[model samples]
Target: MTEPAAYLPVLQTGRWFAHLPPDFAQPLLAMAHLRQLAPGEVLFLRGDAPCGLYAVVRGAINISGTGGRADEARAAMLTRLEPPHWFGEISVFDNSARTHDAHAAEASTLLQIPHEPLQAWLTAHPQHWHALALLLTDKLRTAFVAIEELALLPAGQRLARRLVMMAEGYGQWTAEGQSRRVIGISQEQLSLMLAISRQTTNQILKDLEARALVRVHRGEVEILDLAALRATCY
Candidate 1:
């Protein structure tokens, strides 16, 4: 048996793997390989064959699509996933090509679990199916929220909601013990995620800054007032 890598502890902390029984999760650790990715690196492109499951140990992954435009200007981001999140399961479950492209939003560390061994193990341990089902359900719920926001809310409200979600879901505590949400994304990326024009996104961000709700900097947005920011989600 292969000795677990030093980073196996980090993978064990992930929500998807943490709840599994020790007997089940231990084998997965042995099969997992750690991968380091540079900023803007493409992990896999859409339509690539399913290879395995991936969990982010550090930094972020941008899941996006490239549209039909010749210049690829019509590309849009679906979501940004940070540490303790797993992806690639959709393709693994169906044995289909990747549905979207995954890129490293920053320098990142990932754990890749190859499909063949995982599938074989899962076949023998059908009792673990519920965990996989729960994971898929959470992803679906997030998609539903994004769809509702895009269809019913104005651009400003949608942007606000996005910011709040980012802060709450991925933020960290400051040295002073304050809740500080730092979104490591550019304005253009934000606009793409929100499905709005960059100019509109900038205008809304400026408004939020003026109101002391957030501080927008190059390549990042810092949540200064999380409560007020959450209020805008309504």
Candidate 2:
């Protein structure tokens, strides 16, 4: 049998895998399957069987909900998952159809483990139950934050919060101390995630840029004042 390392880096770094009971490791590792996805490719659709969870190994994945009109502003949030981030987990736990569609935001590698084997392994390793519970708890917290953003925040505020969140979550230092360069993500994509019209999103971006809080480049967005940007998260 191929070892875990022989499959992909994602399974090796997954929080769920890392926290699994020692006894469950070998079995879980043995069943891991790896696949590479091209940019713009769909890993799985929303209604696919709630099989194994997926761990991102390289590149990014965007998770979007199903059943939204293209122009209705259903607010398809882009998760921007990095290595070790798991998706499709809720479906795996609940044994329901996948509630969201996951796609490669860039050329990516992923590890998938079948639900049947994972569940069987979990059954024998009751010690892992607490870890699973904690994982679910974190997911719930994030979901609540998303709900709050959608329900309470105005369009500009929602957009501001997302920019700050993305910058804090993914930006790298630019040696200017105050300036940090964010990864290449288009405004259209951000607009889709924010569930606002492209014109509205563009206007918000301009306003932030004018305030000297951010700088939008060809594809990258640079943070000039983290504190000021965060303050806009009202």
Candidate 3:
């Protein structure tokens, strides 16, 4: 595959590739193949054989589980991954089938590194294992925090925290110094991620809007006052 000029630059921005030495990082970049997805396209499904690790180069991808249903649209979304994020590491490490479905939340670009090459690289450069471990640990810590929030936090607080996290995860400022913390997600998707009823989520969002903490639109939510939103997390 012809390497896109943007490939290396984009990979460098990701936490997954940030700590890699040039020797190891260069070879891994060479082995990656670019993959593109249209909106709502399925990248992989639960129970599907693991293909490789994926890094989101641009746009968003949704990770979800079926909740014992056949239709994917009905699946409960776990999270949305923006650029500079890597996933599918769990299945790659265990050599097991994919545990969740990954779909394009919008038109997306990805770099897929096949399992064999990744395994070989890891084996050859065992010292680099620490960086990979750090990546996995970060994911685990996020999961643990989610579990703690679900078990202990009230619904409104959980919603507040989720929005704040999303803004931090995916938001960016433009050169004009404008805080463009607009999240490209609908209320329904937020409800699924938080595991809350749509009605309850809508009410919470309406309350935030009333307080000038957020501005909700069709398929998007913009953070109006990030400091105030963070204050709600308590």
Candidate 4:
């Protein structure tokens, strides 16, 4: 496969790769190959031999289980990869088959690097491990927050928080410096993420819309007042 034009930003912007030793970054970049996925295409299936890491250059990919204890989307919403975000690293790190399925939620561009190449590169730069450790620590904290929300927060509050979180991750600044998102997610998707029924999701969203906290249009929800949303979560 032909190598990507540049994988540096993919790695540098990712929580996992940003701290790599400078020496390790170059070789890792060399191993990356660019690929495009159409909407609804499967990037990989669960239990497939792990190849390497995949980082999104543009668009969205949804990670979910194919077969495991729960073996369904309800079990997890593993990760949603947007531009400059990495996914599929868990499989690479463990040197095992993929534990989940990665599918394009929209037309997407990705950079995929082979695990063997990445491992060889990392071996040559032992100091890079420190950054990986820090990345994992932060991930653990994030995981804890998810667990806490599921255990203690109501479904409406959880939905509100999840929206705010996605906005933080993908919203762009407007001319007035107000953050706006172009996310095209649906009520059913939000229902799944919040572990609620579609009807409930619709009701909550309608209430938010009535309050001018958010706007719902065809296949999209725009957060109009983030402060109101933060308040809604409480």
Candidate 5:
């Protein structure tokens, strides 16, 4: 049997995996299958049948949606995920089709725990099901907060809050060190997530830069002061 200890260090950077019981974590990592993706590759499309749960080991996964409409705005980019975020658990519970499109925003590595094997394991250890549900609930909490931001916050404040949120890995950041300081995202991608114009995103980023709250690079934003970034949400 493969030892879970071999994989634990990297996976432990993600809060969800770190919290799993020894019995649960051991088998899950042992059963996990790996896949590599080329940049721009489609991992899964909206409406596809659920396959399994996935954890991002490296690189970014872009979660997005496409609606069949003449309107250009019908296509929306949601969030970009990096290690060691886990996703696709919603369909695992409900046995439903995928709710959004997932693509490799860059060359990416993933560890997937397939539907059948995971179900078999869960049947024997039903107590660990709560651990799985916690993953879904964490996402729900983020969604609720996002909804509130969209309705009440101005574009600038919202963008600042988003920078802070992304920097913190949407609360999945349990890793120590510099991983949390650099957010690998482009301004255009940020605009898509916020449903704002690229020009607006550029201007907002510039304003934040002027205040020394962040340093924007070609394809990333480094948080110079995460606390000040959060304060802008007001």
Candidate 6:
């Protein structure tokens, strides 16, 4: 794989990587190689042994699975992660098999920093492991927020909040000034992320559309009003 000269900004602008001390950040960036995937390609599967870290460079990654608990789309699918989002770290930290499936939601480009080299680098600079821990905690907080929403919110509210989160890139993207007017997710993927059925998703989206909060398009949802979308969350 060739070095992606154009992809560094996507990583550099993200909170986690941007804050890393130069000594730690420079070498890691140098070691990364590109992994390209065709649409629908499986990047890794549940139970697959740890491989490495991945950062979305161009397209989206469909993250799904239930750790052998359930296979239904609602129960299985997690979130769709887009550019600037880095994943595949839990296994690298714990040396466990992958806990979920990561597939290419579309033709995608990922930056892969292999496990062996990364582990060696961390061992030599143990303090930098805290950096990785920060990454984990960032995700943990997002997961906790999602769990709380699922427990206390209605389906429509939950869906609204999820959209807001995606548009915000769960905090990984807000700094980049990325155009988020349109969220590039299909209805099926959106429904799965919310653990709701397609019919319900469509109906709720239509309800939002009727209210002029959003404009639904083919395979995408345009936010007619970001403030309104955030307001709907609460």
TM-score of each: 0.89, 0.79, 0.90, 0.83, 0.93, 0.93
Q: Taking the tens digit of each residue's C-alpha lDDT, what string does model 5 give over 1-234?
A: 433345567789888989889999988988888878999999999899988999988798999987765665476788998888999998889889999999998999888899889888999999999999999999999999999999999999999989888887887967653337888899989998998999999999999999999999999999999887888888
- Candidate 3 lDDT over 1-234, as tens digits, reads 546446777666554576677786777687788899999999999899879888888899999986653563465889999877788888767889999989999999998989888888888888876776766788888889999999999999999998887877632211222233898989999999998999999999999999999999999999999989999999
> 201, model 3: CA deviation in Å?
0.6
Give candidate 1's error at residue 211 in angstroms: 0.7
lDDT of 1: 0.81
Give stretches of model 1 more than 4 Å off. Answer: 1-5, 8-14, 69-73, 170-180
lDDT of 4 by residue, 1-234 (tens): 434655555445554555555565566667778889999999888889988877787788987763345544245455575766666667656779987788899998888887787777667866775655564466567668878998999888988888886766532211233343645677877776666788998998888888988899876889888887988888
Q: Give lDDT tens digits, candidate 6, residues 61-162.
A: 988976433554335578888888899889979999999999998999999999889998889889998989999999999999989988999999999988
Q: Whole-model Cα lDDT per candidate?
A: 0.81, 0.71, 0.83, 0.71, 0.88, 0.86
For candidate 2, give the lDDT of residue 101: 81
In model 3, what are the clashing residue pairs, if there are any?
none
lDDT assessment of candidate 3:
0.83
CA RMSD of all predictions: 3.5, 4.7, 3.3, 3.9, 2.3, 2.1
Model 4 ranges with Cα > 4 A deviation: 1-3, 6-21, 66-76, 170-180
Query: Which candidate model has the greater lDDT, 5 or 6?
Result: 5
Q: Which of the two, 2 or 6, has more lDDT? A: 6
Candidates 3 and 4: which is better by lDDT?
Answer: 3
Minimal lDDT window, size 10, model 5: 1-10
Q: What digit string (tens of lDDT, one per residue) describes model 1 on residues 155-180? A: 99999888877765532212233333
Report the lDDT tens digits of candidate 2 across residue range 39-141: 9898877788877867677788888774457676465655677666666668757888887788898898877778888888778876776766766776677
Residue 121 displacement (Å), model 5: 1.7
Question: What is the Cα-based lDDT of residue 38 in candidate 2?
Answer: 96
